[model samples]
Target: MSDGAPDSLIPYDEIVQEALRAVVGRVLGEVEAAGGMPPGSHHFYITFKTGAAGVDIPAELRARFPDEMTIVLQNKFWDLSVADDHFSVGLSFNQIPAKLVIPFSAITAFVDPAVEFGLQFQAVSEVEEAEPHAEPENDSEQGAGNGVGSEDGDDGSNVVTVDFGKKK
Candidate 1:
């Protein structure tokens, strides 16, 4: 990994990203099983690709965010449903309730500040071998507009980002 060129035999980056994405599923599943977040100040800020496959959100929300958006799971949310590969929930925006269905593959970041936990992923569409994007100015930085964090205002402790090269 220290070398400039990646190894051809192993898709180590993709494999690791997949595993981290699974952690998103497991955590969501746990919250679903418990009826809600455990009895504490625990909550989640899930940032995802709005345009990714399997993502379903209101037109207004899509129009507003277009590319990515972060949602907070705290009070006043309803209908928490978790599936093998996706999850859905109802949240309020400016007093208007909206239902959002997001596949685990669409998520880019997951953060739980109560425990300072976070996992970042590359939206499946962002790293397709068939499509290439311009490089960022710095290797440590993400592409323009890809670094938008949550508007939820969680004291941001450990946000993670994993770039598989394409996954939006």
Candidate 2:
């Protein structure tokens, strides 16, 4: 059979992306409901695109991260607020405090290593334009602290893959 073209019309990518973003929102909502990070667990690794629309990263951070960046939420974080379209959190870097506001649409990944749970997202597009600026000293780096549990099972290697691909 010749691998050519099929005639059909449906917006699967958008639908899947929307659903995945919801999962992020729901998770954050749960955390918010719990008042704060649960005992023995106190951080997150949030990776997102610097250029995504509605993303409100600091000017300095934009320059350093350029394309993408990961943030750590632990000891020195505060005012964590999650909203329908986005979420905001305050984190300290080198004794300097900075606020980060990220739109769910811009998040490319969310991982809670303490629980061995992680989620990967597809970037909206590669052609998206990003603003250029320098990252402030107040932006925290990724994976800077240690929490309670291992991010894996016995052997320390396990990954759960969720394929949102459409069946032909």
Candidate 3:
């Protein structure tokens, strides 16, 4: 036998990623069903590729975050709507209210800092890497700063990380 493992014919990574993305959809759906309000201190930090297909954000936001952007869904947000493959919500940027429509496929991370739960996924798009930009000003208090992509002091036991380790 060869030292390397043989590649499997199944697209396990894609399947698993799709399934995991559904968790985000379900959570958002619950909030939507609750009259667009999150229960208690629950909030979410959603990170997505700005250039990904089916992503719709204000032109200024797109310009500000040409590569990727992270939006917080907490107090001061409204119109929380969730669809099968996408979700849209209204959030304020610099006190300017804007509606963002982001597809689940474009989402790379979802973090619920209130419960220290998070999910990280591989990019579904061939996004060109660019300099990281500051998080958008959503007019919400920057709490413990448990950002979806941050590796803070938290043990992150609740964070679900998926890495297929595809061979080149």
lDDT of each: 0.73, 0.66, 0.81
**Residue-wise C-alpha lDDT for candidate 3, range 1-168, written one tens digit per residue:** 866778879988989999999999999999999988889999988988887778899999876666678888888899998999999999999989999999998888898888888899888744433223434462233333225555732674588878886564
The candidate 2 region of ten consecutive residues with least summed lDDT is 142-151
Point out the higher-scoring one by TM-score: 1 or 2.
1
TM-score between candidate 2 and the true structure? 0.72
What are the TM-scores, per candidate, against the unseen true structure?
A: 0.75, 0.72, 0.83
lDDT winner between 2 and 3, please give it. 3
Sorting all predicted structures by lDDT, with the top scorer first, yields 3, 1, 2
Structure candidate 2, residue pairs in collision? 60-134, 60-135, 61-135, 63-133
TM-score of candidate 1 against the unseen true structure: 0.75
Residues 1-168 of candidate 1: C-alpha lDDT, one tens digit per residue: 464554468877878888898888888788889996644888887888776777899998775666667888987788898998899999999999999999888888887877877777765644243123323242234233354443333565566666656543
Off by over 4 Å in 1: 1-6, 126-157, 163-168
Better of 1 and 2 by lDDT: 1
